[model samples]
Target: MALEDVPRLGCGRSIDEVWAGIDQPPTGHEEHCQYCQTARTRLQRLQEATVALRESDLHDPELKPRPGLTRAIMDVARAEVRRGNRLLVRTTDHGTIEISEQALDSLIRIAATAIPGIHSRRCRIDIRTLPNSPHETTSTARAPRLVINFRVAAAAGIDIPKTVDALRQKIRTAIPAGIGIDAGTINITVEDLYDV
Candidate 1:
């Protein structure tokens, strides 16, 4: 289901709303409602994880993420409160491992910025799930194929085709290496140019 289509808790509050008010004092309904309390607790954990991840990334000198990357990471973290559109990474007898779409977007942005002369603008990920073989077991279920639509700005005087090819190759390799998920079709658009 789409993020917006995801159902609200019994208290009628979306997780997004809860996250927005995470720092505020709890309302009477929130204090008494079990669903609201649970959502708040879980969201707080997610908030902590986001902060930790940001700190680690910032301290890693080799990463050198683009300017405003921290803000972008927080924005994605906030949007992830809706918790929809997760891609399956693997399946086992124990359970399935999934990664959020926003996390993948952040990974893509970071990967794109690693290529010199390329700056990521925006990206969207779509997934197409192929039918499983009739004999295949649940533990070995196939993951949905990922199709990425990425927009970027290139440094002036850069060879557009060559640099973009490098960008594509970077994304293709990075996704699998970073998250253990294979990237499928990648459509890149050089939407703007920036001075180097």
Candidate 2:
């Protein structure tokens, strides 16, 4: 018989049901049912394995979340509630280049983290478009200029101004290199200090 046609257990209790109540003391019926005993044993082993994996991930530095992870998550959540904003990079007769705010925020975070002893925090990007001239065509209209406001935490004993300068340079380079657009004005704020 096909797997779908077979009953989950001889006692008619599914493995899922047994697993859900695994923490509680087994009922009288479970004590007498071989299927319940077997399912419970297997599920206990699975739970043990899951716990072990979580511990491993915690100890692994590479698996640790980046500095701005919480901010990034909140940004995504807000974007979901209100549709994500997109920036126009360039416009041509053939097509236009655009990048989502979420994507650009992620890129900026990546650039900030590249500098040692720096942890990214909140990042916000603003765009201002110059009014089109009467003679300017759609393809010829100027692209919007971007302003980036970024917050970060610096490690103790690090030179704040020098490190921030490096961070600004990195973002300027990364923006144009990663996506074909210039980073107009970058403002970096050192909000807090963290131990190494």
The candidate that achieves the highest TM-score relative to the unseen native structure? 2
lDDT of 1: 0.87
The per-residue C-alpha lDDT of model 1 at residue 152 equals 94
Report every candidate's CA lDDT.
0.87, 0.87
Overlapping backbone residue pairs in candidate 1 total 0
Where is model 1 more than 4 Å wrong at Cα? 1-84, 133-135, 139-141
Per-residue lDDT for 75-95 in model 2, tens only? 989878556788776767678
Worst 10 residues of 2 by lDDT: 132-141
The runs of at least 3 residues in candidate 2 whose Cα sits more than 4 Å from the true structure, single-residue gaps closed, are: 1-82, 138-141
Residue-level lDDT tens digits of model 1 in 18-59: 888998988888999999999999989999999999999989
Q: What's each prediction's TM-score? A: 0.55, 0.56
Q: Model 2 compared with the native: what TM-score? A: 0.56
